[model samples]
Target: MEKLKVDGVSVSFGDNEVLRDVSLTLMPGELVSILGVSGVGKTTLFNVISGLIRPSAGRVLLDGQDVTGSPGRISYMLQKDMLLPYRTIEDNCALPLLIRGESKRTAREAVREKLPEFGLQGVGRKWPAQLSGGMRQRAALLRTYLFSKDVALLDEPFSALDTLTKSSMHRWYLDIMDKIKLSTLFITHDMDEAILLSDRICLLTGRPGTISREIVITEPRPRDGDFALTEEFLEYKRLVKEELGA
Candidate 1:
C-alpha cells in the first residue's frame, strides 16, 4: 500500500495559488524528491503535507486514511536547524516524545539509545549552540525521526551547508533512512542533490507548482560521489534542467 498520497490537491494563500491539482504517491520506504526552482511552492507543498496549512482543495492520505487536516502524523525538517539553543541536544530531541505524553525518563532513554545511531552519542548533554552546523542538522534529523512518524517532509534541509558537507550529509541521510525504512518527501532546488538522494525525482513547473516529470532512479542503493559522475546521472540532471528552463 502507498504510504502517503496527495490527491488532486490545490492550495492557495488568499488569491495566490501555490499548488494546482498536485498529486503524488509515496510507497513505503521510498525516498521521493520534489525538485523545483525558488518560489515554485515546494516548501508550501511540504507545509500542506505536514498539516501546517490546509489545502484549499483535495485530500492527503496516510496509510490509506485521510489525514488532510489531521495533525502530527508527519514530521517536518526545515533548512534551518531550528534547535533550541538553550536546551541540551538530548533534551531537544526528546521534546517530541515529551509532547506526546511520554515520561521524561522514557523519552531520555529512547533518545540515549538512538543517539549513537545518529552520530550524536556523547554530545547529547551539549547545547545546540556548541555543535557544528552538520552536527546540528544531524540532531535536527534525529529529533524529527525520533517522533516515529510514518512520513518525513524535509525542505532543503542541507542547502545551507558547504558542498562537501552537504554531500556527506546526503549519504548519512540515506543510510539512516535505509535503517528506518521510512517514507520521505524531500524538497530541494539543487538538481544534483535531488538526483543523488531520490528513489524518484518529481520535477515541478515554475510558479504555481505541478509535477512536470517523474524520473525513477533505477541505480543500486548506497550511491556515492562516484555515482554523480556517471553518464546516466549527468543525463538526468541535463534533462531536468532543460525541463525547468535552468
Candidate 2:
C-alpha cells in the first residue's frame, strides 16, 4: 500500500481559480472522503490528484515519488460505471488487465475467480444493462481495484442507487475493502455517506475550494445500520453542516 499526498496544490483556469493551496494525505488502507456542495471544486481537486489536470502549483506524490500531471498512477472511478455497453461484464472488468497486455484468456480467467468476492459471481457473461444499479457499481469497483490495488479515487459511486441499495452497498464495500487492502479518496456531497464510510472527512469550502477542516470519525469500522441514528453520527453531520454553511 502506498500513501498519496496532494501537497500545497492550486488550480486555475485563466483568472478564475478553482482550488488553492489544497493539501491532504491519504494514508495506506485509509478511506478518506472529500465533502462539499456543488461547484466547490471537489471534482477539480480530484482531477489534480489523479493527474488528469496538473495543478498550477504544488505537487502530487505517491509513495514519495512526484507524479503530478501524470495519469494512470492511481485508479479512478467516476459517477457512472463507464462500462462499455457492448462488452460483457467480464470483459469490462478485465479491461485494466487487457490494457496492461494480459492475454484475453488470462484476463477472463482472473475476472472469473474474482467475481464471487465482489458479489457478482456467474454474472460475468451478462451485459451491463442486465445488472441492477448496485451490481453495476460492484463490477465497476472491482474493475477499479484491478487497475491499482493500492489506491482508488471514487466520485459519488453510490449516489444513484436507492436507499436500500446504497445501504447494502455500503456494508459490502467496507467488507471487501479490508480484504482487498485498497485505500480510497472519494468525493461525496452526502454527509451521511461521508460519516459512515470515511476514516476522516475533508470539508472543502469557499470559492477556489480548499480543505477548510478535516473531521475524523472515531467510531470503529463495520458500524451497524443504526450507527447513523446515534448521537455521535448526528454530531458529525452537524459539524459538517455548520462547516458547509448549510
Candidate 3:
C-alpha cells in the first residue's frame, strides 16, 4: 500500500496561487525526489505535506487515512542540518524522542544504540561543531529518523556539502536507507543528485507549480559508481529537461 499520498493538493497565499493540483505518492520504503526550479513552490509543497501549511484544497493521507494539516505525523529535515552546537550529538539526535516525552537517559540510550547503524559511532558525546558537515548531516538524518521510522521529508539536506562530501553522503545515505527502509520524499534542484538517489522523480513546473511528469529511474538502486556516467543517467536528464521546457 502507498505509505503517503498527496491527493490533488493546492495552495495559495491570498490571490496568488503557489501550487495547483499537485499530487504524488510514496510507497513503503521508496525514495522519491521532487525536482523543480527555485521559487516554484517546491518548499511550499513540503510545508503542506509536513502540515506546516494547510493546502488550499486536497487531502494528505498516510496509509490511506486522511492526515491533512496535522503536524508530527512524519519526520522532516530542512535544508540545513540545524544541529545545536551546544548539545552533544547524542542529545541533538534525541530531541525528537525527547519531544515525545521519553526520559533523557532512554532517549540517549536509543540514540546510542543506533549510532553505528547511522555511521555515527563514537560521536554521540561530541559537540555538533566538532563534526564535519557530512557527519552533522548524518546526525540530523538520525534525528529525523527518530521522529518517525516509516517516513521522512528531506529538503536539500546535502546541497551545502562539497562535491566529494555530497557524493560520499549519497552513498552512505543509500546504504543506511537500505537497512532502515524509511520512505523518503526529498526536494532538490540538482539533476544528478536526483537521478543518483531517487527511485522516481516528480517534475514540478508552471507558474503555479504542479507535477509535469513522473519519471521513473529504472536503472536500479544501490547504483554503481559508473551509473552517473551512463547513458541512462543522461537520458533521465534529457527527459527532465524536455518536460521543464515544454
Candidate 4:
C-alpha cells in the first residue's frame, strides 16, 4: 500500500526556486531516504511533503487522500533533538500525547512502558542534560512517533553524533522500526548512512531540486557491519556519486 505520496511537488521563495517537480512515494512499512548535496532543496521538498510549506504546484497524498498544504497530518523531526531542557525525558516523550489532551499520568505511564524500548530505562526521569546525544535523539524520535505513528519525516536526525554512536543508533533505529512498522522518509547527505538505513534512496539533484534517481538497495534489512565494505555497497556508492556528480 502507498502510505504517502508527493506528486509533482514544487516550491519557490519568491523568484528563487527551491524544488521543482519532485515526486516520491512511500509504501506501507517501507523506509526511504533522500540523498542530495547541500543547497539542492531537499529540506524544501520535505517541508512540502510535511505540509509546513504549501507547494507552488502538485499534490501531497496520504493513503490516497489529498492532503496538500495540511499540517498535523504527518510527523516531522527537524535536525535538532529539540527536547525541552526543563522537562524530564519521560515528560518530553509524552509531550505529544499531552498535547492531544491525554492526561499527564496516562501519557507518562504510556511513555514509561516504552522507555526500555527507547533504550532509556532508568533514564526516563532524568533531564535531557544527563543523557548522551544519541539518547536525546532516541527520545526525540519517540516523541515524534507519539505524534504520528503512520509516517515520519526525519531530517538528519543523527548527524550530530560521532561515527561510533551514529552506527549504533542506525542499528537501534532499524530494530525499532521493525517493531513499530512505521513508513519513514528521511533526508541525509551521508552516502553511507543513506545506503545503510534505506531500503531505497531517492536522489534530489539540480538547482530546482528534482528526484532524479531512485536507487533500490536490494540488500536485506538490518545489514551487518561489513555490508558497507562489500561490492554491492561500493556499487551503490558509485551510482550515488555519479548522480551527485561528486
Going through the candidates in the order shown, the clash numbers are: 0, 0, 0, 0
Q: Which pairs of residues collide in model 4? A: none
Candidate 3 TM-score versus the reference = 0.98
User: How many angstroms is residue 148 displaced in model 4 relative to the true structure, after the best TM-score fit?
Assistant: 1.0
lDDT of 1 by residue, 1-246 (tens): 999899988988888988898999999899999999888888788888888788999999988989887768888889999999989999999999999999999999999998999999799999999998999999998899987555788999999999889889998988889988868999999999988899999988856789888999888788888889999999988888899998
Instruction: List per-prediction Cα lDDT, in the order shown.
Output: 0.89, 0.92, 0.92, 0.91
| Model 2: pairs clashing at backbone N, Cα or C within 3 Å | none
RMSD of 2: 1.1
lDDT leaderboard ranking: 2, 3, 4, 1
What would the per-residue lDDT of candidate 4 be over residues 125-228, giving only the tens digit for each residue?
Answer: 99999999999999999998888876889999999999999999898988888898878998999999999999999999998888899999999987877898
* lDDT of residue 140 for candidate 3: 97
Q: What is the C-alpha RMSD of each candidate to the true structure, in Å?
A: 1.0, 1.1, 1.1, 1.0
TM-score of each: 0.97, 0.98, 0.98, 0.97
Q: Mark the regions of model 2 whose C-alpha exceeds 4 Å error after superposition.
A: none
Instruction: Report the CA-based lDDT of candidate 3 relative to the real structure.
Output: 0.92
